[model samples]
Target: MTAGIGHPMETQGSGAPGAGGGAIGLDELDLSIVHALQIQPRAPWTLVGSVLEIDPVTAARRWARLRDVGAAWVDGYLSPAQEDMTWAQLEIAVNGARLMDVVRTLCDDAGVLSLKQTSGSRDLVALVQARDVDTLAEYVSERVCRVPGVQGARVHVITATPFEGSQWRLRSLDAGQRERLRQFDETRPAPGTPVTAEPLRPVERRIAVALGTDGRMPLAALAREVDASVATTRRALGRLLNSGRLALRCNLARPLTGWPVSAMYFASVPAEHLDATATALRTLPELRFCTMTAGPHNLFLDVWLRTLHDVHALEAHISRELGHLRLRVEERAVILRTFKHVGRVLDRHGHSVRSVPINTWK
Candidate 1:
């Protein structure tokens, strides 16, 4: 959940170190810890230690070190599927010289959840969310388009996201270890849950925001964040989670993983075939996020590959396999850098360093 919008896939391809700062390499233990969280973001250290063959205290200390350096973290998302809201992706062309300045300013807004510099006709791509269609339209017109360095923007409103970031995982752990942590899997809303209308409860919204900062925060700390009693906080949290009002997932610095390359593809599919195509696309392990969007291109796909060459290889496989729909890829581009992801400000290498509170619920 880029604070406000739909969840973009968090895949970075393998490559050399990035510029802007030195890279922090992760050893076998760090990778194992990340894989543990990918399976269950809220798992207890004892469980993780048992799975990885380490003392619980040592496991906690190593994770803390990774968290401190922005190498890994867990965050919360407000489910777009369950919430009545507008989700859109923005392609903004900015004044070249002031690109960094413009991104810094936009990062302060909760509505712009994910921002990326790309290698294509558009300089920036953003995932945005708002309370309703009118609010989204107004914000794009008055707030986003009018930003000092913005030249123009094209909006692609998201219709349905069948697959997203939280579903992706690291493959470091063996099957035996993964099965041990699989018992805690309850990350998504149960099927057929009703959509929630606007105007979330005050304390519930506060709890969601606090999770965006630290997904593993204790119940007592959450109560403090919202100034409510621990029992009250626990009850609200249970309701939010059980009802699918809130979403949580573990995230790590993508660049540090073996896959560091990121790419985006925009394509068109017949309205009737959209659902079938997305269902077929979900099985692709490289898929980061896939959505049926309301725009010239009905399909938007983001993925990470092992190498830059794999970009075209995956695209070719899609066109060849789904040719019955005459699915044409209108445009494709790779990400140059990500300035902000969801609510976290990232370094060029995609590590979270600072967080701007996600204010979408307000």
Candidate 2:
């Protein structure tokens, strides 16, 4: 999950409401709409309207406004198949003079999933993905380590991802609204199942590319883009989604939600207790990302909190509850700014301004 560190009302252009400003205030209805999508990203506008007690057209219009201003967006990408994919985190200590340049170059690389300028011993922290362990090793040893900044790097290969961004929710809606949205939700595949590494057909690739830009695109529009009949397109989409190959996510500007602080923790946990520890961590509402990695620090967590002070409270709580897990905290870093999140290019305020589709095969 990505969070911004900007003020709620900050803006760049005219001060007019809904204009291109640094911050956009969201009303109760707007928040409900976002929450509805968060629960079921591709839910029909009519269904969303019913859940939020608004007209279907009004619901669509409101979402259009948010999407046009870059306050919210929906993205679809190929999910990592356990048998064929690998995820890793990199901590790079770059030369001071070339930090910005190096960051820009890494952000433009398709393999780098998220890049952030952080406050800690390291200058930058990156989440990257590869086809396999060997590919990840070569990418780190050759491509990333050989960057012009001329700095040493530390790599942590993720071995098991117990929880990730897709499982995160804004939790702003009421219980009734959430229950209404859940009817359209799809069940996520269990971890460790081997998904067939099938190559996408040309038409399927085209559809995926289109959805990458707007996961909530209308079915008719998607069919037109792929030059296929609506029924055929819908069937293909269902197959892709059910095949455990594609994932849809609804992302919103962090400033709008009032939870702006983002923090990452690196710690070590015994192998035997990793599963229980990870499962417990996933129960926290603030937990955004959690994984077991192959490194000195075996566990990593990314969380979003209401304020910086809450970080201490959270750490203390974790220590008290799961102390028996023998989690050894190694390093902690606050994400000062995020340049890219998932597959979308974000602005300083964490709004998705543009999308650079993540095609792992490319």
Candidate 3:
């Protein structure tokens, strides 16, 4: 959902990411600033500074420094507005030689939220979103399946996302600061809650898209970007933010993070144990996104571990403690590289370079 985030500066400078393509080495303050924005991406400098015990100017400057290096970024993408919207995980088999070409073509498409090359049975894995079942079916049949080098695609519709990335944060923030900075809690909607499906207003659409790349853009700058009065823009923004139709998150480059390795687990939990199994997983700090999918494997887990050895340890830990859940780890894959994630294009080292706006409405 979201990663390390920073507030936008009054001015931005262009440059290559952190030196020599090595570890970002985010220090205490840097991590704290990221945690502040992660908790609330659009938090003002004054609020962040007060809570983090730093000057407003310092907070803004630090955020700019991190952003310039592509160490951290804010991202905004689709939120499930209604029940009809479908989320799918695509395990794609590609012809090896045409890998880059397939990635180039699919990255530009709005529905492909995230696509990455992996080390396993599938050449690629893509997280796709669409308006409805028919829309998703059409996209797969006409667009994805027909792609030149696509050997095959197995689609797993995400039935229930018990946990997601937005709810995560660095342990850098202390209890008091964490408690005080709770403006927006990115909690998942309770089951059976009525979701709104109201259409986005013209100005709202423009504003939402503009924030995808820079979620922490200043209100004044944001107003100018959308070409509307500050008052009009603010009103629209307030509605959109409180509306629960928009998903805004900040992302950090995983390679620079201590937990650099990314892995996926395909597991199945019997109907009776699904809820308890998901609840048990919430205790795992390494778990990123855990979803219930309609496939042979009912649950899919995306995790970040410090090293490859940790993978086996994690699985063993699950098996030892949660044997009663009847969860079976069916298939596993190590993500070699992620070319594009949630619309942001990343460098080889995983630093975000640019973004292709999500075009879900169309």
Q: Which candidate's TM-score is highest?
A: 1
TM-score of every candidate relative to the true structure: 0.89, 0.86, 0.87
lDDT of 2 by residue, 259-336 (tens): 678888888888998988887887777787887889889988898877898777777677767788887667788899
Better of 1 and 2 by TM-score: 1
Pairing residues by index, what is the TM-score of model 2? 0.86
**Model 2 residue pairs with clashes:** 10-22, 10-23, 11-21, 11-22
Which ranges in model 3 have alpha carbons more than 4 Å from their true place? 1-24, 80-84, 184-202, 227-229
Cα lDDT tens digits for candidate 3, 244-307: 6666787777754567778898899898899898888877778878888898899989988877
Top lDDT hit: 1
Each model's total of backbone clashes: 9, 4, 4
lDDT tens readout by residue for model 1, 103-123: 988888888878999998999
Q: Which stretches of candidate 1 lie over 4 Å from their true place?
A: 1-23, 185-199
User: What is the overall TM-score of model 3 with all chains considered together?
Assistant: 0.87
Taken over the whole model, the C-alpha lDDT of each candidate is: 0.80, 0.77, 0.77
